[model samples]
Target: MLRKFSSLILIILFFTTNLFAQEKPEVQIGGALRFNYNLSSWKEGQKTRGGDFGYDVFRVNAKAKYKGVKLNAEYRLYSEGFGGGMLKQGWVGYDFSPENNLQIGLTQVPFGITQYNSHNWFFGINYYVGLEDDHDMGIKYTHNDENWMYAIAFFKNAEELRFGSASDVSDSRYSYDVSSSADGLYRNKEVNQVNLKVARKFASGNSKHMLGVSAQYGGLYNLDTEKTGDSYAIAAHYELNAGNFNLKVQATKYKMNPENPADQDSEGLAMTAYGAPYLVASEATTYTIGPAYSVPVEWGPISNLQFYNDFGYMNKANDMYEDSFMNTTGVLVTAGNVYTYVDLAQGKDHPWVGPAWTNGLAAGTPDAEWETRFNINIGYYF
Candidate 1:
């Protein structure tokens, strides 16, 4: 199946460039192919069998541009059945300039900075990007300049990712059927919800400094029966580079419903904040920092070797009651290398992960709170 898709995309690109190059502004085609695997090590007491090995996400994206109009299609295959076998993302966009662009179709909700980070596997230090994945079908707009950038989106509340299927309320005791029409697409079955996001970027080349700030809000409806919670968050990240050494810092403050509320006593969908991190117990906030260094390698087929150690501490704060929220923290050590090829580059990154330490933190599940996680992948982005 993967081979077939790749071949089809190549064939389309070949014909479109040769036959329609004059008619079209340009059709540039490129994407990344990533194969990710996780190594899960049991904690002091916890034992789980299914959370180990195999590819987590296998995705391919293809894009075409003609004049100011652009088309994009992405397909993702997963090893686990957590989110189904295969999913597709297709969208159309119009680029007004290098700083202004707008796209509408079935794309992800722009709610998290980490979620937007490249999925090249070798790009970041953390094993996991965030608490939840924020993706949905929507129309998105983007603007980028020197010091400011923003994204505005409007999504269909009916086909929301959090509430995948309304007809088959498997998790909920209540049963409801989804409408089979376009009107159902925009209609918020329970509570009407929308998202608003804005961000700014600051950089100083002389000092090799980069910084960003972002905030967003996501509202939910039918808080009782649906039990869907709303969320808001603000986050910031900064990076500094000097010679071969690098330093980075990141922090986020988010508020949302608890993952497991004692009073609620029900299983409901969670609302993710601006950083795409799950909000719980009225709210959950976290902060993280790390430093890394890279050294040019003279070994076989390796360009540079890099390593970093980072730690994250997350907990519930404010409006504290007898809620089922707890503080979770993780320590990580990641190392990887870069390999350059004729027309592509590949790299592998993995982290020695520690368990989520929750002792003396708060009230919540404490099932063997520790485990080792591995994330390694080979990717080619053109």
Candidate 2:
């Protein structure tokens, strides 16, 4: 499959260049270096030590255009604790017209929200569960116009850095992908996924609105059983932009039914991203709400400030599984060639929030307490 896909790209490029190579290709290169400081309420020792401040990541972005053909790629390097360097996204596309285009390679999945579902740097709960801003190696077709937008995609699986059936699954990915658990109890891989997304745009006075729905269906291949099962997600979302205020509202429901051995628990499956692995609930309903407002200001290098509050809630279908929640209130500061995110985020049954280790996203500990983290991420972009 990989070889065939590669060949297809070459063939298209060759034919297109021969048919329309009248203009020179244009190229651009840029990137960023970022660092973070965090003080967590759950990390008592770290608080005693005056919080943790460290290098976050450095990334490079490259893009090129040759008539209707376009390419964009980004490579990132993170501290070893996060994950080693890896490709965030790389894709080749052709613009059929102003309203239509097709992309192939590692690209973002057209899911619940188009670009991002959260206003803060720390995305909503959906991201951790593989429902938001998730990308895979696939082909996607998109159409856009004044009144509507639509997209459909088919992905063979997540990035093929390593075979999923192997005992060790790669966690150096931008988004969560189904994989083996640390204990190796649940081992499943995503396959044959299909996604459909549509949105309607309208405006009235100073307000603009986008209302959309998304559906996704995919197969889950369990290594222990060597049989394929299925998973599906459906969502309804709305976005509003009025003057300097923006709001996002979404409701999503998802489920996974994977074929597993008798000894393994079928209630949940393992998934990983960012150098870590954990269990995800087999069935759940999620909701997200966010509101943001931007104010223009001129203070030294600062030009604007955006204040936002994003919230997410996950309700597990099984009573034995505890629900999960996350909320972030913050401001984004934009300066000349620099951006910073100042946020106070709180979570219940969330791994990143901490008191409980890897169990926050799965069955969840009954004694889980709400935890908070105050963070600031600064980046220089060029």
lDDT of 1 by residue, 1-382 (tens): 9999999999999998887666546555555544444444533333354433344445567878776688887665544433433335678999899999888876655543444222222222221322223444567788778766677777654233355544421211001111111212111132233455455555555456556665655544432244454556666766666777666665667654322334442122222211111212335465656565667766555556555554455555643322221111221222233222111111111112333222122232334243344444444454
Worst 10 residues of 2 by lDDT: 160-169
Each model's lDDT:
0.44, 0.91
lDDT of 2: 0.91
Give stretches of model 2 more than 4 Å off.
1-21, 164-167
**C-alpha displacement of 373 in model 1, angstroms?**
3.1
